[model samples]
Target: MSARSLRQVTLLTVVLLLGASLGLALSLRVWPVSCPEAEPYQLGRTGRCVWAAWAADAYVVDGDLEQARERVSALGAQAADTVCSLAVGDCATCRGGQAEAGADLAAALGLACPDGVEGAP
Candidate 1:
């Protein structure tokens, strides 16, 4: 092949490789996890963490402080303390006295809940 054609082919290959690498990195790094109908214990770390956080929030909203604490305990003692704070009138925007601390903890853990109206009864 001509020198110019060879250079063009090499450049094209480099671009294609870079594009593929970027696509792969994004797919693996920012992928979504959906495990509806499964218990938190049945999921991977991210899914489990998210479920526990949301469940804690649900329990808090329902005035079930014991269950909320149990779910938050799965996250960690630090998380439990931070989240449980909301249960004790420490929050300014808790809905109808329901603490939203679980959602905060989930977000802090770098996970977003699946699309839907959160905290719907």
Candidate 2:
């Protein structure tokens, strides 16, 4: 082949490869991240794991904030607050006692609060 023709072919190949590589990179970055199979929690819209309902209940009732904090740390403060607001609306009244609070928190988390547990709704 003539040198001019060969150069044109080489340039075309390089440009095509570069374009394909850029497209692939953009696609990978734009794709949503997923949680591994071992995780039992659902990921929020932003691809972050929402807190375990049990953990939040434990924190509210038993003052076991460590486990809850560990789980929520991935969500950041603002996201955690948002999740809390969605799950537990006007729950402050339940704080009068640990036993009642625990049941209320469980109910707020969509779990079955034990029968005859006061303040559970």
Candidate 3:
């Protein structure tokens, strides 16, 4: 191939590679991003509630019911207050997390959550 043509191809390949890399990076970030909506246990926000719920679930899985209850109760108390402050995306995420945790905790405690709250996979 002519040198001019080769240079053009190389540039295009580099551009495409960089674009792909950037897209991959962004996609990865979207999936496993850290909680950024609230301070842990300090604010009465959905994020805090969700985090507490998750903590409760983990505690329950580890066979600690008292700790799990404490976590869920605290989160539940705060959830209503913080729900309004969260953005739509954050609110949905927080609510989902809380529900999942609550369900897991309930299951661990042998309580029937007949409402069928979803749990995280």
Report the lDDT tens digits of candidate 3 across residue range 1-121.
9999999999999999999999998886555544655523222232233455446557777888887667656666543223222212234444334433444455554443333234311
TM for every model, in the order presented, reads 0.31, 0.33, 0.33
Tell me the lDDT of model 3 at 50. Answer: 44
- Colliding pairs, model 3: none
Instruction: Residues 92-112, candidate 2: write the lDDT tens digits.
Output: 222234334444554443443
Candidate 1 clashes between residue pairs 3 or more apart in a chain or in different chains: none
Q: In order, how many clashes per candidate?
A: 0, 0, 0
lDDT of each: 0.50, 0.50, 0.50
- Which regions in candidate 2 have their CA more than 4 angstroms from the true location? 40-121
Native RMSD of candidate 1 (Å):
11.4
Provide the lowest-lDDT 10-residue window in model 1: 39-48
**Deviation from native of the Cα of residue 71 in model 1, angstroms:** 1.3
Ranking by TM-score: 3, 2, 1
Model 3 lDDT at residue 56: 56
List, residue by residue over 1-121, the lDDT tens digit for candidate 1. Answer: 9999999999999999999999998876676455454323222323222345456657756877676656666777645444434333344433333344444444433333333314311
